[model samples]
Target: MNTFHPQYLNDSQGNTISVVIPLAEYEQIVKQLDELEGIRLHVNTHTGKRPSIPLDEFVRQRMAFSKPIPPAHNGEPIGSPLL
Candidate 1:
């Protein structure tokens, strides 16, 4: 296992304010988080319907669902309110 010591920065009041970790460790953590996110998304997609179907049925159903849908509201531009 790779272990590292983190350095701390203190404020004028002599209290620890922040910590600094190695860049390699930070990159590794980020990579792990990304992998976890991918796994979570995959699981969520598969579990969208319970009692997951067999490989063949799943492929067929996925193909059916992958079909293109009609454009929205006569192709009018839609604005994102949250943006």
Candidate 2:
């Protein structure tokens, strides 16, 4: 994991309200979160199944049914695209 240098946003009373990290770190975090979610979903879906497959195979199967994440374009978001 990359070491994050986060900037804290403080409220009027000096209470930390939010943290801002580098964009690269933020993107990496988001990607990791997505992967964790995928793993969680895969586990939930296969809880009682008779046969089991590898994580990569499960991810491939899931991706086969899901829409691909659109490439970021002109400052557009990763998953969402401007139609």
**Per-candidate count of clashing residue pairs (backbone under 3 Å):** 0, 0
Q: How far does residue 33 in candidate 1 sit from its true spot (Å)? A: 0.8
Error of 1 at 11 (Å): 0.7
TM-score of each: 0.51, 0.52
Clashing pairs in 1: none
Residue pairs with backbone overlap in model 2? none
Kindly give the stretch of ten consecutive residues in candidate 2 with the minimal lDDT sum.
74-83
Quote the lDDT for 59 in model 1.
74
**Candidate 2 on 1-83: residue-level lDDT in tens?**
56889999999999999999999999999999999988887887788534568878877777777775656777565753211
lDDT per residue (tens digit) for residues 1-83 in model 1: 76867999999999999999999989988988999988887888798934556888877776666644445688854543221
- lDDT (Cα, 0-100) at 70 in candidate 2: 57
